[model samples]
Target: MFYAILAYHVEEAVAALTPEEDAALMTDLLQINERLYRERTLGPAARLGATQDACTLRGPGAGMVIDGPFAETKEQLLGLYVVDCATRDAAIAIARDLRRVNPTAVYEIRPISLYLPGVPFPVTPS
Candidate 1:
């Protein structure tokens, strides 16, 4: 089964990280990602851009485009990871590994009901 791990974190808290601090965190996270890749369980993963750069289209039909996520929450969705695991516990274990490296971030794991493999594209590291 495939699970989607949604990462959430306070925008301000994440933004406060120094370049070195951020790089160290990413390095640790990537190490785990590399391991998952070798295991052939890792799928598409992405770190979303800032909410300020996001737009929301709500209402019926075409809908109106609104600026920002506009969600009333302290922590915003930061990134996500998709992994193929044998069981829910296995998926949770993967999230635990991510939490070990990023203690401040929150991960919500959900089983994927339907998955569509879209066009493949090269992902440039940030």
Candidate 2:
């Protein structure tokens, strides 16, 4: 089995989620999390705040925590999901379902490279 990360992001959804929508989304997340828990494979990952809320490091031994980031870019990272699946398609399936929440919401689905002891990687044909 391999691991993958489903990075969820939104542009202006911050504090934009309606009370009902928020509750619904939370319920969906809980259901998914519970399924993953039962499977004992997939799992719920951490939810990181926006870059603006990040404690950024400027220079050596220098850093600061701010309310907003300097960069003015669209699509802010909302949250993420970690999964242990047999294939990328499986992970993509999960990511695809999340699209139901907000069709415009972006998700970066990337695999978590695994390097197990004594397991050799594939060799390319020269």
56, model 2: CA deviation in Å?
3.8
lDDT (tens digit, per residue) of candidate 2 on 1-126: 555554545535746879998788778767767777797766546566556655444645656545565544466666777777788888777777667654666777877776343455585564
Error of 1 at 99 (Å): 0.4
TM-score of every candidate relative to the true structure: 0.91, 0.66
| Alpha-carbon deviation at 115 in model 1, angstroms | 0.9
Question: Residue by residue across 1-126, what tens digits does model 1's lDDT show?
Answer: 999999999988889999999999999999999999999999999988998899999999989999988767678998999999999999999999999999999999999999887797797787
Error of 1 at 2 (Å): 1.1
Superposed Cα deviation of residue 103, candidate 1 (Å): 0.4
What is the TM-score of candidate 1? 0.91
Let me know the TM-score candidate 2 reaches against the reference structure. 0.66
Candidate 1: what lDDT? 0.93
lDDT of each: 0.93, 0.66
Error of 2 at 125 (Å): 54
> What's the residue-level lDDT of 125 in candidate 2?
68
